[model samples]
Target: MVAASGADARKTIHPLFIRVTHWVNAFAIFVMVLSGWRIYNASPPFGFEFPAGFTLGGWLAGALAWHFAAMWLLALNGFAYLAYGLVSGHFRRSFLPISLRGALHDVLVACRGQLDHAPGRYNAAQRLLYIGVILAVIIAILSGLAIWKPVQLQALTALMGGYETARRVHFFAMAAIVAFLIVHIGLAVSVKGMLAPMFTGRAEAPR
Candidate 1:
């Protein structure tokens, strides 16, 4: 009984590699977003520019450099995370068996201000949201590549419906990611002890 209790008391919510990759991906995404905004401000996408204060790099040339640098980091780290998740079965264990009905139920529960705080499993809503974010990141990367090297990556640009369409897709993908981040941060703050696991790799024992 004592041994069982000890095991239960020290649950591992995330492994070391996952934690490291997660933080690195976060930093890369942040740099890309800010620098991308700066680059976009140099040429408005839809006849409107993002505010200068909200952007990075301070100039078009500097912003382009920062964006490309961060893009490589984001690609490498993102793919590493994906490969690890697949090979380790982390994705299957954490996000598999998701269904529309289950997600709807979780959404209703969340609406009622009830959230499952189980340390060993993610709720359906989390699984769905996480998967959605992953797809969005893939879209952003593809579209970005199309825009970055339209002449060299002509086939990719055409696949994305040409350079202009790819740019639009990239912009919308970034917007979706930003929206997800806002919700993610809000949920983290609302849930007690939610943020600690990402840092310490262990969640508080389920109540």
Candidate 2:
């Protein structure tokens, strides 16, 4: 076997802990969706009423357990991501392109299929979408927690326009995440040879 040389020790732009945390967050979202749906089915929400007959799971008790447990997992994953970004200096690279005017311009360009030529770690459109999704996740967690522990977080619920409004906002946040996932995965697949970086830490393209 050949001995390792200095060149073998060089670092590259591959998936780091932040990327791993992001994927874990994605998986946690999936689990949350399933458990949340089960909970919703047990008490179907139509405008306002939470009917018991809609439940498809074992019972409301089980559904609550699953939902809260999945929620904690999601929250923990998000916290870990935040800590990684802060500790590793990855946040600067990820969040640099956040100008509203520039993002809007990029959005228009993307709509016209002109983003292929854009350069940067994240093009304007990607920056807008990623930032928006992060905000959405934050809102989702806060609203959900308020609803989950209404008596404990009554002030927060009221801040979000009362309990009923908080619930609606929480649902909207979940929808945003689902929609983002569809678009994000589609982009990942459409890009040629993009999967290796996350596992190995070196992106195929120059950073």
Candidate 3:
């Protein structure tokens, strides 16, 4: 943990893999949000539509491209992290914690805005969030594909309650992921500045 001369005060900010894939995920999320909005505009929801001057072609076509492209970025960054975590042994030490009861307790605290006492490298609440996001991403991809090619995926679409129903589910899943991201960032700032550890790979407490 030796710091470079003159840069002694500033710690190492992120291992190479972490830093790279993190930014990549951030960028891809941004693109997904932007393109997703455009796609939404074509079909409008809740009686709101994309402005008249703005059009991202027909709804399905635009959404399909943007969604799949963003999916690749998310998947790439995710798998990279997976490999790194396993190889570096961080997955077990820093990521895995046996505390289902404690986790549930932490969730209650988080709901009350009392994150100061949350435990573990990621806290129970944070762990739940990360896990939820991963699941949501998978769900969104599957639901999206069902919607995109209902005819080809007729079985899946049927399982989802039909083509239009699958599309609705996909849209809802995207919204849920976005909501989770917002809350995640907010929670990070709430507790010990979470970004620093992601950047520096070190926190006040050992992983």
TM-score of each: 0.93, 0.80, 0.70
User: What is the Å distance of residue 177 in model 2 from its true position?
Assistant: 0.9
After superposition, which runs of candidate 3 have C-alpha atoms over 4 Å from their true positions?
A: 1-15, 49-68, 83-92, 95-100, 110-120, 204-207
In model 1, residue pairs whose N, Cα or C atoms come closer than 3 Å (at least 3 residues apart or on different chains), thus clashing, are none
Please give the TM-score that candidate 3 achieves against the real structure: 0.70
Per model, how many backbone clashes are there? 0, 10, 1
Among these predictions, the greatest lDDT belongs to 1
In the predicted model 2, the residue pairs found to clash are: 13-201, 13-202, 13-203, 14-201, 14-202, 15-197, 15-201, 41-54, 41-55, 42-55
Candidate 1, 50: how far from true, in Å? 1.6
When summed lDDT is taken over every stretch of 10 residues in candidate 3, the lowest stretch is: 1-10
For model 1, residues 22-128, the per-residue Cα lDDT tens digits are: 99999999999999999888788788888889888989999899999988899999999999999999999999988879989998998998866687588998899
Candidate 1 accuracy as TM-score = 0.93
- Candidate 1, which ten residues in sequence have the lowest lDDT sum? 1-10
Residue pair clashes in candidate 3: 14-199
Local distance difference test values of all predictions, in order: 0.90, 0.73, 0.70
**lDDT (C-alpha) at residue 136 in model 3:** 80
